[model samples]
Target: MDSGELEHPPAEELQVGPILLALADDNRRRVVAELYERSDGERLCASFDLPVSKSSRTRHWRVLREAGLVHQRSIGNGLYMRLRKDDLESRFPGLIQAVVGAP
Candidate 1:
């Protein structure tokens, strides 16, 4: 331990690799796409029709949230998801477009 110094938690760091990894999954891609296309810019987790199971979706959401690619809010038994477009774009310009934009 260094004298007269404060140790910061590792969780404070936001790594880009996890964000890229979250986008690497096809199902996560779909979820991000839906959230991107939503007129309201938010959606209930139940509203998604992903091919993966609910548990799988939960995992995907966790990855996305952890990567700072998505923001999640819980409401009773469900989750509300919103794309972190501004944050993402601010971090890496045109990244979301390059991934989420392509057909």
Candidate 2:
């Protein structure tokens, strides 16, 4: 193995497969687009105008979080979610650009 591989956590290497799976869903793709293209910064779960119900929205966020596409932090009764831009950029170059830049 290359010495550079040692610098990344094993979990980091595992993110792509899950991220791809998460993006495969239409709702999850929309979620990513909203966060990546619309939101100015970290946003509450309730802020997104997703088509899904609240409970379903939570599940979607969980998928994104598990995929390492979003960073979720609990704040009181609400959860704040932000796109893992740096991680995604480093792991998959041009992906965010393609998704966000899509017309």
Question: Which number leads on TM-score?
Answer: 1
Best by lDDT: 1
Pairs with steric clashes in candidate 1: none
Regions of candidate 1 where Cα sits further than 4 Å from its true position: 1-13
Candidate 2 structure quality by residue, lDDT tens digits, 28-95: 88778878865464788788887878899978987887778887776677778888787888888888
Against the reference, the lDDT scores of all candidates come to: 0.76, 0.75
**Residue 56 of model 1, lDDT score:** 87
Candidate 1 vs. true structure, TM-score: 0.80
The per-residue C-alpha lDDT of model 2 at residue 10 equals 36
